[model samples]
Target: MFCLHFLVTSLPFNELKLGRRKYSERMYAERAKPLAQYTTEELYARFCFGRDNIKYIADLVRPKLQHKTKRSHVLSVEEQCLIVLRFYASGTFYQVVGDNMGVDKSTVTNVVKAVLVELASLVNEFVSFPKDDQMAHSINVQLVANADLIITNCVVKWPGSVHYAHILRESALYRKLRSNRPNGIILGDSAYPLLSWLMTRFPVANTPEQAGFNSAHCKTRCAIEHLNGVLKRRFACLNYLRVEPKVACNIILACIVLHNIATRRNVPLDDIYDGPEPDEMQPGQPPMFAPNEGQTGRVIRDAIVRHYFRLMT
Candidate 1:
C-alpha cells in the first residue's frame, strides 16, 4: 500500500493525464487547409467531386445549415458545406472532418444531415422522368438549356441482384411508360430482355439482316452508356457510396439535381476522356428472370427490326 501510494504520488500531473485533443486545438490546428482558400479549379482537384456542386446547393440549403450561439460561435453555412464535401470526397470519418476543419464531430454530423435534407427537397425538380408519354433509364441524363434531367428513377432498392428482367415489369417507370405512351420505343442493351416497350439487339447476328439490327441498336444504346460514364465520372460518391442505402438513394437524386445546376451555370464537367468506371467481372452466369414476350411485344420488336433499323441502314 505504501509503495503504491508513493508511486502514484510521485508521478507528475502531466504524466498521469490522458492525451485527448482539445476542441480548439483540433479546430485551429487542422492539417487539411480550408478549401475556400483555393480557386475553383484547385478545389476541384482536391475533392474531385462536390466542390463545383456546392454553388448550386448553397442557395438551396445554406440558410438551413447555419447555427448561432452566444456562448460558442456555430459553423457558418459555408464552413458546413466544406465539411460535407470533404466528408463525401474522402469518405473520411467524422473525426477526420473535425480535425481537418477544426470543428466538433457532432457539428460535422449535423451539417451533413441538414444539407442532405435540403438537397432532398429539391430532388423532384432535378431528378424526374420526362413526364413524356414514353421513357428511358440506367439513370441517363438529358440536358435541356442548362439542367441535368434524370429520365428514370435511380434507385438500387429493387429486389434480387443481376438486373433481373422481371424488375422491369415491377418498375414504376415501366408502368408509367406503358400507360402513357404504349407506342413509344425504348432501346436497351442485351442485359435487358426484350419487351413491347423495351427493345434489345439481336443476340447473335448470323445473317446480314440480324447484323444490321444489332448495329443500329449498338449505335443508339452506346449514347446512354456514355451518359452513365459522364455522370459517374463527375460524382465519385455514386461510384462507391459510403452512406446507408437510403442515404445513398437521396445522394444519388441530389447529385442529379446538382449536375443539371452545373450544366446551366456552364461549369465544366469531368472530361469523358478521363476514362469510365471500372467494370466488375461477374463470376457466374447472370441469373435470368426473363419471361416470354407477348405476341404483341414480339410483333413490335420484329417490326422495329425490319422497318426502322433496316430502313435506317
Candidate 2:
C-alpha cells in the first residue's frame, strides 16, 4: 500500500503538458490547413499547382496511404500530396522538405516514393496517343487522348544511357498503335526507329523541298516539344534530373498531371511561361537501316508537303 501511494504521488505527469507543443508541431509539417482556409488561387500559389490537381492525386493515392500502425493517422492524403508537390516544385533536399512538412527525412522520402508509385500506376489513365477510329474523335473518348496532351503510351526510365528507340521497339503501346493504325503516322526524333506509321525528319535540308517538309513536320510536332519544355520549366527538377530514373519518371508524369490540370483550368504557372519556348526539342532522322519510312510513308509525306506548299503559295 505504501509503495503504491509513493508511485502515485511521485508521478507528476498530470502537472506537465500532455501532448507535443503546438509550436513544435506546426514549425515543420503541421502547417496543413483544414482545406477551408485558402481560396483556389492562394492554394495554387502555396502548393505550386491546382486544387483539382490535389483532388486528382488524392483519389489515385489516398487509398494506398495506409498507416504503418493502423491505429492512428500519421499523414493525411492531402498532406502527402502537398509534400510531394513541394518536393517537385522546389527540387530541394528531402531534409528540407521534411522541415517544411514537420516530419523526419525518412518520412519525406517514404511519402514521396509512395506518392510516386501511386502516380506511376496512373500513367495509362492520363497519358496516351490515340489512333484514327480509336474513339479519339468518337464520343467514347477513351480511344485516344487529345494530341496536345498525349503521353505517348508510357514514359522511359533511363538506366545508364540506354537508347529510347530500343524502348519504343519494346513498348506494347507502340506495337498496339502500329497494329491499330498501320497507315497512320506518329512523330518522333532520331532517338526512335522509323516505321511506315512513324514520321521522322530528313537528316539534311539540302533542297528546298526537303527543307519545307522538315519545317512542316516540326510545326506539326511542336505541341509535344512545347509540352516537354513546359513540364521541365514548371517543375524545375527535370532540368538536371538528380534523382534515380524511376523516381524521375514518376516526377515527370506527376508534373504532367498537374500541367494538364493547369491547362484545363486556364491557370498559368504564374505570369511566367505563357507557352512553350521558341526553340523546341526538334524531331530528328534516325540512322539508316535501324528501321525507317517506306514508300507509303513517302506518299503521305508528299501529300502533307504539297498541302503546305499550296498554303504557302
Candidate 3:
C-alpha cells in the first residue's frame, strides 16, 4: 500500500514540471510586445540604464548609518587627499560629490576644509621667511649684493580683514630688509599707505614714477591673475559654489594647494580665456597706466624682471 501511494504522487511530478514550462512560455510571450508602441516616457522607464546604473552603484557602496556609538567615522590620510584632489580636479558640487562618494554634503565640506588646513600648514613649513640673523644675511647676500633695488607691493584694508594681502606685504618686506644692505629699495603703488610707512622703517623704492603703476605692472603681475584663471577653469564648480563664504574660502585655498602641486610637477595650465576680443572701456574711465620708471626705479625693475625670468626658465 505504501509503494502504491508513492507511485501516484510521482506520476503528478511530471505534469507539474510541464505546467511550469508552459507558464514560463506564456510570460515570455506577454513580455514580447513591440517596444515602439510605448510612449517615450514609458520606453525610458523600461529601458534606460545608464543613470539607474550609476545611482545603483552609488547606493551599493554607500555607508550605512551607525547607531549612536563610541566609534567615529574613520577616513585615512590618503583617502582625505583623494577627496581634496577630486574636489579640485572635477569641480563637482558638494552634493554631487557626496552622492558619488556615498556621504553627506556636510561630510564632504568638512573633508575639504580639513585638507586645506593641513596643506596650508605644509606650505608654510616648506616656504617661509628666514629668521632674524639668517634673514638679514640672506637679504644682503641675495638682493643687496646683486640687485640695484627691491620693489614691494602693498594694499591697505580695514584693520581686521582676514585677507592675506597685508600679511604678505609685511612678510616680503621683513624678508627683504633682514639683509643689512642699503642698495635694495622697496616700491609700492598709490593704494598702499604702508609703502611710505615701510620707507620710513627702511630704505624703500617708492617714487612719484611708481605711483599708479598697476596697469603697467600687469605685464609682470599677470602671473597671479593667470593663476586665478587656471584655478577657476579647472574647477568650474568654484564659480557656482552654494556654500558659506568661509567654506568657499577653504575650498579656494585647497585649489591653490593643488595648483602649486601641479605647477611643481611641470603641468601646463589650460588657457580658458582664449576667446574673442574683450570689451572696450567706456568713456570717462581712467586711462590705463603702463609701467613707467625713472633711472632709480628702472634699475630695481630690471632686477625683478631678470629674477622672474630665471625662475621660469
Candidate 4:
C-alpha cells in the first residue's frame, strides 16, 4: 500500500509541470496590479477630509458628561468637523461615512449634528453679516450695488423638516442682511411662497423675467454650490447617508461653516459650469427690463459685491 501511495504521488508530477506555467502567469498578473496613487495632502485636497480638523469638531460635539467610560472612542472636535464637512461636500450617506471613519452610522450622525449645533453658535458669533453702520453701508454700496439684481435661492425642503427653510431665513446671517437692507429688492424661484406677509419685508420680484434674470445670476452664487459639491465629493460617506434627519441637518450646517472658512482663506473656485447659458438673451424676447431700471439694481448690488471682492482680494 505504501508503494502504491508513492507511485500515485509520483504520477502527479507530470501534470504538475503543465500547471506550473498557468500558475506562474497568474502570479505575474497579480503582481502587476496597479497601486493607488495619492499622498496625504493630495488626498486631503481631493477628499476635503482632514484628520487635523477632527479634534476641533470633536470638542464641539462632545457631550458634557461628568463621567466617561474608558472604552469609549474619544473623537476630537476636529475629527467631528471633518466628518460634517465631508457629509456636506459629498452628500455621502451616513453608513458610508461611518465605515470610512471606522465608526458606526449612528455615531457619525450624532457627531455631525452635535458639531453643527456647536459650530452654528460659533459661526453666528464670529462669521456674522455686516452689523456696524459703516460696514453695512459699504456692503450695500460695493457688493449690493454692482449686481444687476439680488437673487436669494431658497431650498424649501431639506432632509429633516419643512421648517428648516424658515430656520435658514431666520438665521442671524440672513436677519442681519434683511434688517440692514429693508428697501432691498430680492428675487427667488417659484418654489418659494410669495406671501403678502413678506412682500412688505422686502420688494420681492418673482416674475418670469425676474426668474430668468435670477437663473442667469446664479453664476455669481455658484460658490456655495461648489462648496457643497466639494464637501460631498471629498468624503465618500456623504454619497449614501443613512443618519437621522436632524443629524443630517447639523452635518450640513457644519459644512457651511467650513465652506465659509475656506472662502475666507481664498480657496480657489471649482469650475463646473459647462452647460448652455441661461442668461443668453433669446431673440425677440424684448429686453426684460428698461435699461435704466435694471441698471439701478445692478449698480447697487455690484457695488456691494465689489467691495467684498476687494476686501477678499
Candidate 5:
C-alpha cells in the first residue's frame, strides 16, 4: 500500500488523467453579467419582462429565494429570478435554458422549483375567482377574466380528461354561487350547464331575441378567451409544460401570478407573438350536467332576452 501510494504521488498531475481526478477549484461561470447587459427590449423578448419589472420581481421573491449559503457560487436573488423567468418565457428544455444562463441543468431545475413554490404561494393575494392534472399529460386551467383581460379568478387543478363542467361543479365558486348566487349573471359557453348565476348559450336560438342574446353573450364572454391567449403568449412555456403533473401545476400557477402582474403593469406583449387560445372541446356538444340545469337559469335567460337583447336588436 505504501509503494502504491508512493508511485501514485510520484506521477505528475498532468499524467494522472485516468483515475478519479480532483479539480483545484469548483468552476462557476459568470452567470449574471450577460443577462444584466440586455437592453430593455431584449430583456422583454427573452424574460417576458423589462429590466425594471425584472428587478421588481427579484425584490418580491428575494425574501423567499435568498439563501444563506456560504458557497461562493451561490446564485443571487436576481439571478435566480432570471433563470426561472427565462424558463417560463422559453418553455424549452432545462439544459437549453441553463446553457443560455451559463449554469447547469440541475441548477436550472432547482431555481425553477424554488421560484415556482414562492410565486404560487401568492395566488390568493393576486387572483380572485368569483370564488375560489395529468396523463400523456395535461391539466385544464379554468380562468375568469374581466373586460380588461386581467385574470380575476383561476382554477388549475383538474386533469386534462376532466370535463369542464365537472371542474366547475367541484369548485368553491360553484358552491358559493349555489348558496349565495351571483349578483350579476356570468356567461359561459355551451359546455357548461346553465345555472341561475351562470348563463350558457341557448341550444337553438329560434327567435330573433334569442339570436341577439347569443350574439351579446358571445361578444362579452370572449374576454376569458383573450385572457387565455395573452397568458400563453406571454409565457409560452405554459403552451406545452414538459414537467411532471405536480410540478407542471405549480408552474402553471406561478405563471398565472406573473401574468396578472404583467397585465396589471401593462407590460407590452408585442415582443411575443399573439394568437388565439386553442379550443379543445368541439362545438355543439350537449351541455354537461343537463339533468342538473337550474330552472332559475332558464327564467333568467328568457328575461334577459325579453328585456335587454330585444331592445338592442
Candidate 6:
C-alpha cells in the first residue's frame, strides 16, 4: 500500500468534514388531547378506569402527590395517575407508555414509582380479610375474596415458588383467623392445607355425601377464582412484571387498591374477554404435601359435609 496512514493524517480537518456535529434541538410533545377531553369509553380503554373513577383516584393521591414546586411543565397529579394506570392497563414497556403520555422514559418511571407508593398506602383501608369469612397465589399472593368478587384480603410478598399453604401460614390474616376465628369458613383448593377455618375439597369422596360436598365446595370456591381472573384481566401488568421484586410487590398492592376502587364504583370490565369461566380450575398445579393438616380442620369439614352437602346426596 502507498502509506495510507500518512495520506489520512495529511488530510485537513476541514476537508475531512470533522467539524463538531450539531444536534437537533429538543422538541417537547403533547398528548393529542387533554385527559378530560377524552370520553368515558376512551378513558376506560387507555387507563382502565372511568373518568369519574380516575378523578376519584387523583383526589385520593393529591394530598400526597401534588407537586410541591412551581417548576415549569410540572406534571399534575391527574396526569401522573393516568401515566401509571396506562402502564398497568397496557403492560407495555415504559418507553412506549411514556410516548403515549408525551413524557420521557425517566419521567414515566418516576411518576409510576411515586403514584404507586401513594396508591399502595391505601391498601390497608381498601383491602382486608372479611370478618364474615366467606373466602378464598402467585408472587404467590394469597387472596381472600367474598362472593361478590371483592378482594377482601391479599398477601403479596411471597415468592412464586412458595407454597400456597406456607404463604397462608405466614400471613397475618391466617393468625387472625386462627386466634379470633370467624363463624363462616374460607374455601380453598387441594393446593392449600385444610384448617378449621379453611375447607378444602375431600381427597377421596368415600360416599355420595362426600362427593356432593366436594362439588358444592368447588362451585362455591369459584368466586375467588373469578376474582383472580377479573383482577388480572383488568390490570394486564399483573400478568408479568418487568420491575424488581420489591417494586413489583408495591405495584401489586397498588393495583389491588385500584381494583377495589373500580369494583366499588361499578366500573365495567372493558376487555374483549372476561377470560375463562370462573368454574374452570387452573391447570398444571402440582399437589403439595400438607404436613400441617390438623384433625380439628378435618372435624369441621366433616361437620359441614354432614349438615350441608349430605342433603344434596
Among these predicted structures, which one has the highest TM-score? 5
Q: Measured by TM-score, how close is model 2 to the native structure?
A: 0.71
Which 10 consecutive residues of model 1 have the lowest summed lDDT? 1-10
Badly placed stretches (over 4 Å) of model 6 are 1-27, 32-34, 132-141, 270-293
RMSD of 6: 8.8
Clashes of each: 3, 4, 6, 58, 0, 2
Scored against the true structure, residue 51 in model 4 reaches a CA lDDT of 41
Write candidate 1's Cα lDDT for 1-313 as tens digits.
0000111224455655864433222123332345556777877654543454665556677666656555334456666667776765566676676766776676677777777667777766765555444433222212211113233454445534534444555566666666665445666555455566666666677667678877766655555555566566666566776677777766666666656565556656656643223222234534443455445566776786677556443
Runs in model 1 lying further than 4 Å from the true structure: 1-36, 47-53, 68-72, 133-152, 159-163, 272-293, 311-313
| Model 4 agreement with the true structure over 84-114: per-residue lDDT tens digits | 5555555667666665555566667676666
| lDDT per residue (tens digit) for residues 36-130 in model 6 | 67889988888889778888999999999888899656788888989899999999999888777777788889999999999999999998765
- The superposed Cα distance between candidate 2 and the true structure at residue 70, in angstroms, equals 7.9
TM-score of 3: 0.42
The parts of candidate 2 lying over 4 Å away from their true place are 1-30, 34-37, 66-73, 134-147, 190-194, 206-209, 258-267, 270-295, 307-313
Better of 3 and 5 by lDDT: 5
Q: Candidate 3 — worst ten consecutive residues by lDDT sum?
A: 140-149
Candidate 5 residue 278 Cα shift, in angstroms, is 9.5
Q: Candidate 2, residues 1-313: lDDT per residue as tens digits?
A: 0000111223345445564322212222244452557787776666666677677667767778755665343677888888888787778888777776666777778888888888767766666555454433110011122454444454455453444555555567666756565334566654454455666667676667778877766665555655665666667666776687667878777766666556665655643334433432324433433323466566766676667654443
Rank candidates, lDDT, best first: 6, 5, 2, 1, 4, 3
lDDT of 3 by residue, 23-104 (tens): 2221111111213244534422332212333233223223332123553334444334444555655667766655544455
Model 6 weakest 10-residue run by lDDT: 1-10
Model 6 local distance difference test score: 0.76
Residue 20 miss distance in model 4 (angstroms): 58
Stretches off by above 4 angstroms in model 4 are 1-39, 42-73, 76-90, 132-245, 266-270, 275-313
Taking every candidate in turn, the Cα RMSD to the unseen true structure, in Å, is: 8.6, 8.9, 18.7, 15.7, 8.2, 8.8
